[model samples]
Target chain A: MGKIFDFQFMIEIIPSILKGIPFTIMIAVVGFAVGIVIGLFGALFKIYKVPVLNKLTGLYVSFVRGTPLVVQILLIYYAFPILIKLINFKFGTKIDISWIPAVVFMFIAYSLNAGAYLTESIRASILAVDKGQMEAAESVGMTMWQAMIRIVLPQAAKISLPVFANFFIGLLKDTSLAFTAAVPEIMGQAKIQAGRASRFFEAYIDAALIYWGLCIILERIVAFIEKRNKESA
Target chain B: MSNVMIEMNNIHKKFGNNHVLKGVDLTVNEGETVALLGSSGSGKSTLLRCINLLETPDAGDVRINDYSFTASKINKHVKLEARRRTAMVFQNFGLFANKTALENVTEALITVRKKSKSEAIEIGRKYLDKVGLLEQANQYPSTLSGGQKQRVAISRALALDPKIILFDEPTSALDPELVGEVQRVIRKVAEEKVTMLIVTHEMDFARDVADKVAFMSEGQIIETATPSEFFTNPKNERTQKFLERYLQRFSYSI
Candidate 1:
């Protein structure tokens, strides 16, 4: 049997796929915002070599990086409640986390995964700052934290900007993985439409087109920021 | 009255197997400028860094004005206290590249000195003017010339109003043409009677700007005397040999 290509079917499913764009955007924005926060502390712990926190961060980054993100999402979505219930039973305390959405759990998993990657980028950026910068600040009686915040990190942030922008685009694409947890993001909506109409090719193509459009839009925003930063310098 | 601005006693430092400093004793009196004359790897920079606890000594004591810390153990409190009284001008002109010339001068004031924004800016401008970089105050280090950046670094150190200022070969990184401008700014600072410890290779500048000159060799201060006496009548054989070598290479007569 010859395979059939239907441009009309793809066009028809475009609006349905576009409807999931908001959720995709939400996951990307929230995951990245929270990921960067975690990444910064993870970076600082490693940079400063804080006693126990350093080792913990190292283990955490390794685990997240070594495991597939989909596995992490599945674990958080399916097993997280059982783990929490186990804690509640062990401590003889009634605790509930059922109110939270599966999408929330998916975001948490994605945040942690992104954070592990960002940790390396931020740590390298922080390292890329001149050693004499810290020494100069310290010579003027600024503490390490003060020196880092006031002198080093600003420069480091500039160095990490492009890397952060790339991660944001990557995160936007990765939100498609939220479909595995039935979060109704772009891929999830497309899968449902495809299942209903038995038009997998057209529905999936529609989803890919939407994601591609979003990424291109994001690239322009990143380019705008980089251009602005360069002009200011 | 205690006129001593910095007193480093038996300072010792080691980096791995390299014993960079060994029982190096140094003192800088208030309103005095002392130049540390030494060959490279003679522990001159290490000695200067120890005074500010930037390179914590393996052993000994450092006193900056009234604050003192024994280097036998961790004493962040005393180190910070001493650090507040001293600022170092790095050989590399370590002005924060991200900050403008004025911000470089104002950063420590607002954060460490707890000065108001207007007051800090006012003080920053005064020092920038002193270094003759007021016109370039808004410029970042990357855009400034080596001499201008060093001048900004000097202004930053000076603006802190520390009891003592340490200059770690401040003009060493500049081009020969740029060197004079930075040296002139340093000479102006010397005239201000701020206790200064300068580690320098420029014998002429040292003799002109330093009231006292101390020579170091093999991690020890081999000779210390008034600039006139040290240059005219060298005491140690090592000091005489060093001066001869330095003079012959630089083609300068004492």
Candidate 2:
């Protein structure tokens, strides 16, 4: 009771927690990268009002946005085995569940979630671009798709730069949720260390510091990019 | 028979309940510069937009050179064909904000015309030089003056070598002092025998540069004639009132 905090214990466990860094970064980087692609098509479908895809994208976006991240992770994680079983039982196929990795589940869940939010961000950004840009491109003989790729998207990407940075940071920290699926990300490693040593406060502090460090480094890199972008523009 | 560079027949456009262009018929021959004059809400801009299919008309036929299509039946192929033959300079410059002046001029050349980078850049530079914007080639639209931006836009249009160039209130958004620079470039383009249709509020500029001045009222072209006859001996009563209203500001006498 006399010693309020354990600095030495926090230092001792930093290395173990650091081991989870790659998993956290991999999940977040891959999730966000794929999410951008999903979001782009989702936004385009909605913008162009593509018949069936637009409605499906809207339902997907709403489903993801309406639910919590932890719930989504668990739902998708549990749903997969059941889905695979249904497929195997219904069809004459040997679709083994062991082949799929747990990390893949987190990737799918996080990406779908990120994609929903990014769809709105990307859509608003695309809409925010001046109407004249498209007109000018079309006036010069570019088809709609050509104008979109050459003219509209670059400006929209620039407008959504800060949003991308913010969302990526959110995603990086959100990777801690991977613990629910027993994937042993940063928070999972922290929990293991705490249970082993019975020093919950120290282990948690170590995890928090690691997250803060990663966020600071990434924020600096994004700041540098934003500055360079401003100078060029 | 004058070789028609552009022929728009019975163009009708409606914005919700407001009918903007009502059965408008217009023709532009090769090497002709026609300036469209009208007060606000008179649909001059909408008429110009229909040529390139920017704003689709509710009903009409737009023929740009050999590429013509019925407005209601416009498909991707026909739209591109008509659009490729015509270019527009907007009131807002419409320069790609993300692109440098040179890239803006060369982008369509590389993408639409399938020109090589070196060739596109060369063509881009020549047009930029024509508009006197060659020195600002690397500068973005955000950094350039509005006049310079419009000059870049004009050069971008010129680089395409379209059958006709449509300018929608090009100088309307420029500063009072800057308007002269854009006007000068346009005057020079007119001298080069480029077929152009310019929508403008400047009666003096229209008179000075136009081969013919056409006055629009409500949603229709009420009068069209040579600048000399149109300005000096107007036939329509509405044209008399319209000119008097504009000329009154500067106490300009016809």
Candidate 3:
């Protein structure tokens, strides 16, 4: 307890945690890409108020947004498989549905969580585009969907870029939750290393530093994109 | 007889209880230019927007050449077909902020009209040249001056080669110094015999560019005549009063 600081131990654990960086980045990229697709269609449904789907998507976003993401990960990874087993049992069908990868479950959980927040961000950005833009697009014979995809969405993308970038970096950090599902991302690797060495503080500090460095690099990328958008606009 | 380019009958529109437009009828012969002259809240813009189905009228039937659309039961196919024949230029320019001037002009052609990209670019360049904005084709709307933005909007509208064009106070949002450039473009389009319906506050521009002028007050067109007669000898007392007030502001007397 007297010797609290351990610089040498921290330096030693850095390489072990660094090995998890690629997995962490991959989970974030795949999860966020899936989220962008889900979020775009979800937002469009809500924005256009498409019958029952709109209400259903609203409930989904509200439920996901209302719950903690960690709980969602547990529910999706653990409870979802049980639910599927129950359905198969009730139907009396021999379906080999248990072969799905743990990584897939982690991806689903992260994407659903990110998508809920993205729905609101993307919807608001689309709304922020001037209503006249839609009118102008339609006047030139663009259908509602065409106008949205081409005119409204392109402009909305610019408005929502900064928010999206922030969410992306946040989602990257959130990949640590993948450890709960045994996905072996950054936190998973760090936790194992700390447990083996009994140097939890040192290992955790290295993990934090890695996250900080990655986030700083990502922020620069976001700034470069924002600058390019501004210049072209 | 000249073929009818546009016909709107008994158009009725209300924003809740505001009653912006009520039972308005307008016809535009092919190649005719009509200017809608009215003060704010007079529903000139609403009337123009109804033709494109931007603001669906509460009750009306609109015919643009072969396509017909009824407000009560809007047929999306017919509405789209009708809208394809018309273009609109907004007071705020309404150029796509994310697109370059050339892209703004070419987007609809490539997407809705399904022209090949090369063909769309060729047409877009032609219109940009026509508007004298060829040099600025690669520039985005935010970087352009107001006059340049409006000109680009005009180029975008013109590139579609619509049968009719609607301008809702195109120059009203421009600086005084910039208005002349847009007006000159409009004058050139008029000379090309494009059917246009413009809602404007610039009385002199209206007189100079409109083949016919219609004066509206309280959601009704009180008078329609040749621009010369409408400006110098309006029939309705309301038209006279409105023009007098407008002209007086500019230190001109009828």
How would you encode candidate 1's per-residue C-alpha lDDT over B1-254 as one tens digit per residue? 54989888898899999999999888888999999998999999988888888888999887787877789864777667878998889999898988889999999999999999999999999999999999998888889999999999999998999999899988888899999999998999889888899999999999999999999999999899999999889999999999888778877633
Q: After superposition, how far is residue B105 of candidate 1 from its true place, in Å?
A: 0.6
Please provide TM-scores, in order, for all candidate models, with all chains considered together: 0.96, 0.97, 0.94
Residues B5-121, candidate 3, lDDT per residue (tens digit)?
888888899999899888888889999999999888899999998898888789988898777778898768866887888999999988887789999999999998899999999
Pairs of residues at least 3 apart in sequence or in different chains that clash in candidate 2: none
lDDT of 2: 0.93
Clash pairs (backbone) in predicted model 1: none
Colliding pairs, model 3: none
For model 2, residues A82-191, the per-residue Cα lDDT tens digits are: 99999999996899988998999999999899999999999999999998888888888898998999899999999999999999999999999999998888999999
Q: Model 3 misses residue B22 by how many Å?
A: 2.0
CAPRI class assigned to model 3: high
lDDT on C-alpha atoms for all candidate structures: 0.89, 0.93, 0.89
Docking category of candidate 1: high
Q: Give the higher-DockQ candidate: 1 or 2.
A: 2
Q: Name the Cα RMSD for model 3.
A: 2.3
